[model samples]
Target: MGVIYLVRHGQAPMHAYSTDPVPADAPGLTDLGVEQARRTGLELARQVPAFTAAVSGGLARQVATCAGVLAAFGEVHDGPLPEHVVDPGWDEYLIPALPGGPTPDMYRSPAAYQQVLDAALLRWTAGAADSDETYAEYQERTSAAVDRAVELAGSGQTVLAVSSAGTITALIARLWGVPAQAWPTLARAMVNASYTKLLVGRRGITVVSMNEHAHLSAADVGLATFR
Candidate 1:
């Protein structure tokens, strides 16, 4: 038997300008985001002795969170941590790609971008967003990530993966056999840096915890946003 920990990345920069697309390879975390990751790492260290492997999405925030977690585990060598892997499929649900129009530089304003993002998130969660990836495709990708984590955990190992709240919530919805349209209600309660534990064995994968945040103080939990 093995355990897999699905961890959502910590708080991120909520600047109104955040709607601007970051270079695919260079997204960075904000100061508060770093603190969130550090606190999450401390919590994980208290709960689990060591992870057999740590994985994350290719996103900068995911990798940054992994770094914080490794440092907390006292494995801060100057090189790569052991068994770190990245998969694009583990990335957050893509915001609907904007079509040909004014470049980002020509957008209405920061506040306007934030409003658009808020509405888009709502439509996405409500299953009303016409996405490049169909709803079925979205579910399949998330399921594959969970299945891959289970497969990688072979035996007597614990795997930890850092991703986004949306990714984690999508997986949870599948695990609970909930309808996709219910994701908004499902995701609304998720806390950043919180983790859910799943046990995989011969019978099947079992959910041990969902959105566990016992390691964090109340102040360190919940969403942080810039309005």
Candidate 2:
């Protein structure tokens, strides 16, 4: 058996919604986000010392987080960081745009955006999403990515995969047989730069931990944001 670690990318710049058409998949990490990734890497290096390899999702934020964490690990540990690659299969489920391109200012509160996101998910699950992929498609992609990660890990090797909140949570939900309705709620709780661990055995993957961020101290509270 081997271990697979799924990491949520650090906080991104431009988290607030903008009326202007944001470039798809363009956002990367903020300064604080970079530090978060670095801290996470140092923590992981302390915990797991060695990994077979690492992989990252296609998004800039995900790849940047992967690089930051691995770089920090290399600096703290004796060996150079292993080469990592990008796989779009671990990309987050893209929520369809609302009928009107509404900005955060359009909503009464940030929580209201969750309603919009849920509505978008309803459409996605129904195969009526505006984006190229439906929710079902997202499940398929993320599941495949995880299977590939397990294969990459091989016998007793620990491998890491950096991805978005949706991808990480979806994989956990699917692995643990959590109900579909519970997915979004679980995803919402995933802290940025946090990680979930699983033991990949001949039978299948088994969860060791989920959405852990113990490296972030009380003083790092500002870096412990969800958005």
Candidate 3:
């Protein structure tokens, strides 16, 4: 059996919504985010010192987080570490633009924006909203990305993949036979820099653990964040 570690990238600055069409570059991890990734690496090194493969979503945050983990791991372990590769398939699903865009007031309140986002996601996953990348298409892409990790971790090896909360939740929900409608419940709870372990064996993929964040809390409770 092989183990697949799905690590959610650390916190990134939330994108502010506006009527202006100027495209913003995808945000990278914050200072706290960087530290969280380092702490996660410290714990991973102690538990599993080596990985057969390390993959990351093409997003800047995911790439940075993957590097942070590997760098911190190298600090403690003198052994070889897997080369990191970019896999756009593991990227977070593109959130559809809200109708008329969000108002200035909505942007001011994180809670308000979250409420709007939650509704939009619910509609998207339920097939009630139109998007360039349908929810089903997202599932296919993420599954393929995970299969790549499984392939790399063949036999007794272990693989690590850095991704976003939504991507990780989507895979876990599917593996656990949870319906798409309930994805928000799991997605909302994903802590930054946390990892979920999946076992790939003869029977098939099975979720061994979900959202392990003890490493963050052990270092500092404040490091555990969800966004």
Candidate 4:
């Protein structure tokens, strides 16, 4: 048996002209985003002992968040715990065909953009969208990555993985057996840098907690942006 901690990346830069056509792999974290990661890392260090290992999506934000958290742990332990492993399978689902890319002027309001993104996410998760990564493909990749992390944890070891809201939501939906159409509810409620804990045993993975953010104060509780 092992425990797996799935953490969503810290806030990202959200601005009118923020959307750049960079490869999904290289989007950088914003200043506030870095602060969010640092706060999350500090909190986790105070709560958890040494984990077996840590993993993260290769995205810059994910990697930065993982590093921030690890650095916090080092502040106490004063030593590196373990090297981080990068797995693209754990990356967020990308909807290249979405009506418009991430930009300020595309949608009249944040609510409208969210609605459009949500619909696209639902369609992507339900295998109704055509993209480089389908919903089914995402499921297989993320699930496999989690299973592998569990295997690596073995016993008496915790595995921490930093991912995105979409990936985390998809995993939760799979765990709760929720349909793709209901993902909007999950996405809407997911918080940046929030965490979900899972315990994996012979039977399977059991969710111990979802979207835990006790470490964050009320002021920290809100949508975080870098730009």
Candidate 5:
């Protein structure tokens, strides 16, 4: 049997939804985000010392988180690490700049920003986003990426993939047979640097866990983060 781990990337500025200066699409991990990734790596090294493959979405935050996890894992385990693969297919769905949407003042309030983001996501999933990729296309891209990872893990090996909350939760929601409209609930619940586990064998891929973040809290209670 083989296993696959889906890790959500650590937090980025995501200034698109706020007044921060960073560009949402190009920002990297925050300092706390780096720590979260390191802790997640240590936990993975303890749980599974050997990995068959390590992958990340091509985004800056995802790539950084993957490197951090592998670096931490390498510190404790005296084994050769797998070369990291960059897969754009696993990238998060685009968050378009909403026109005539929330004002800059609205971005100042976390509650207001969340409300707008959630509503915008709902519309995006319904094929209303201004972006070129539809929800169906996004799903197809992520699903294909997952298939590639599972194939890489083939038989008694484990694969680790670092991705964004939106991409990870979308895949999980589909596997759980949940409607796409409810995807935001799962995405919102995902913690930064959290991992979801899947078992692959004769019975096919089965979700063993979702959003496992005890490692973060174990390291530091304040490290538990959803944004």
Candidate 6:
């Protein structure tokens, strides 16, 4: 038996949808986002003192989150941490190509932006993807990543896998037998720095927990973000 923890990266400095050109690659974490990751690490270390290894997507947010979690682990536990692996396959699904996308800083209501995103997500998951990376491709790569993580846990070792909300929810949705139409909802609701724990053994990928974010308290004004 082994455990694989999936962590959604902290809130990015800028969101791809909100930012113009949306940045071709990874973006750094904001100050508050960094605190969120640190809290996650501290809380997580309390839950699992010893992790066999840590892994993350190649994105900057994911990489930073992995480091935060490990650093917090070291703070709570007195031992050397395991190696960290970077896998690009675990990255989030690309946004669909829009014929006339909104300009950067166009400034619109959140509702309007969500409307566009919802429509795009529906098409993407339906195989009518408007971009180079289809929803199916996203699922395929994420599933492969999780499968490899489980196989490589090396007999009961615990592993931490940090990635974007889309990738984390896609894997959990598969394990929980969720339909495609409702999958994006899960991703949208996930808080930055939250995690889902999966137990791997004969049963194979059982969900011990999902969307755990107790580290972010209600008193904190701007901590529980789902961007």
Top candidate (lDDT): 5
The C-alpha local distance difference test score for the whole of candidate 6 amounts to 0.78
Give the C-alpha miss distance for residue 184 in model 3, angstroms: 1.0
Residues 17-122 of candidate 1: C-alpha lDDT, one tens digit per residue: 2456566655446666676677777777666777888888877777887777777655433344456788767877654442221234423464565456545655
Candidate 2 lDDT tens digits, 1-227: 89988889998775424435666665578888898899889889888878788999887789999999998888888875678889999877654343322355534464876777766665555566566676677788888888889899888898989999878888878877887777778888888899898888888888999988877645645567676
Candidate 3, superposed: residue stretches over 4 Å from native:
15-27, 96-108, 219-221
CA lDDT of every candidate: 0.68, 0.79, 0.82, 0.73, 0.84, 0.78
Between candidates 1 and 2, which one is better according to lDDT? 2
Relative to the true structure, candidate 3 reaches a TM of 0.89
What's the lDDT for residue 71 in model 3? 91
- For 1-227, candidate 6 gives per-residue lDDT tens digits of 89988888887764544434445555558777788888888888888869988899987788888888888888889989988889887877654353233333432455555566666677667777457766777788888888888986657799999998888888878877898878878877889999899888986888989998877856754588876
Give me candidate 5's TM-score against the actual structure: 0.89
Better model by lDDT, 1 or 4?
A: 4
Q: Candidate 2: minimum summed lDDT over ten consecutive residues — where?
A: 94-103
TM-score of 4: 0.85
Q: Against the true structure, candidate 5 has what lDDT? A: 0.84
Q: By TM-score, is 3 or 4 better? A: 3
Clashing pairs in 2: none
Q: Which stretches in model 2 have alpha-carbon errors above 4 Å?
A: 15-27, 96-109, 217-222
Query: Estimated TM-score per prediction?
Result: 0.77, 0.88, 0.89, 0.85, 0.89, 0.88
lDDT of 5 by residue, 1-227 (tens): 99999999987655523434654555478889999999999989999979889999987889999999999999999989999999999998655443223555664576776687788778877777566687778888999999998898799999999999989989888888988889988888899999999998887789999999998877545798877
